[model samples]
Target: MKNLTKKIRSKKLESKVDLTAMVSVSFLLIVFFMVTIDLAKPKGIGLGLPDKNPEWDGKIVCGMGMGDRLVTILLDDNNKLVSYQGLLSYPNEKPKTLSYDANGIRKELHNKKRLIQEYYGDTSRGPIVIIKPSKKCNYKNLIDILDEMAVAKIDTYSIINDFTPEESQLLAAN
Candidate 1:
């Protein structure tokens, strides 16, 4: 009779060890981690368009080897801003070198932005400025042009180059 009583007491004690609290704590921990974790995302500056292959079907126009409706910025051997068909230029005389001041570049960019809006009606289709620097052009001038591009929020840009097929084939072979 004593053995039976002891067995009953042991069984009751075993059943009383509640696992509900442990399960609740585990669930709370899982939720906390989920809330604190950050979702992985791509890191970089976003561009206006997707990447295109070297042999893309798009036609190459303008002196910069880009399609039509592109803004072309040509730099002569003297490093002067000669003509830009896409962006508006000051009347009478052409500026040799753009000032390094941010405000100056911003003002010019704003004017260009307005012109582009009027021409295309969509500013999001950002104007593609092609930089065609003459062989004898100063390297500093190129840097200035790049700076202006950044200030103007002009992202789509390309450099003009003329490579012979034989040269290209040699490069490919290498």
Candidate 2:
């Protein structure tokens, strides 16, 4: 009788679970993944277009390798793109004139960008572009060419208001 009473008085204990460590570890893992993940960047071309200043001097200032790996694009008021490589003194050949079609400027830009990248892994020493926009070219043509440069992922390009006499003559002939 005494043993039976003792057994009836005893109660079974319940087990407790501690999830604090698990919660902390989960938070740490989340932070680690977030820090390692890479975010998508916006697509746009960053051009080196010089600002117009009143006190400017007239000089044929050329950048490094401007004559060799130079990509010259002349824009007319008619939205025509006259493109070529090397200097304006290349009297032996004429620049290719193309419309602003999908197969036109964009294709040429992509090719030039690829070649420059392949030859020189360092973009700082890659191909340089000279954009000679004639007074005849409308504002839209300028914007479109800039957009094409962005699409091609070119890193180096400039807009020159000063057109050489040789370039002017060549453009006139075209």
Top TM-score model: 2
Q: Tens digit of lDDT per residue, candidate 2, span 13-109?
A: 8999999999999999998788667444456776433323344454434443345568889988667779988776762145788889789988877
Query: What local distance difference test score does each model get?
Result: 0.56, 0.74
What lDDT is reached at residue 170 by model 2?
71
Question: Distance (Å) between predicted and true CA of 104, model 1?
Answer: 8.5
Clashing residue pairs in candidate 2 are 77-136, 77-137
CA error at residue 10 for candidate 1, angstroms: 26
**Candidate 1 structure quality by residue, lDDT tens digits, 109-153:** 667667666755676756666776665568887888788888787
TM-score for each candidate, following the candidate numbering: 0.43, 0.58
Candidate 2 off by > 4 Å: 1-64, 91-94, 121-125
Count clashes in each candidate, considering only residues at least 3 apart in sequence or on different chains.
1, 2
* C-alpha positional error of residue 69 in candidate 2 after TM-score superposition, expressed in Å: 2.2
Error of 1 at 20 (Å): 24
> What's the CA RMSD of model 2 in angstroms?
9.4
Decoy 2 TM-score against native: 0.58
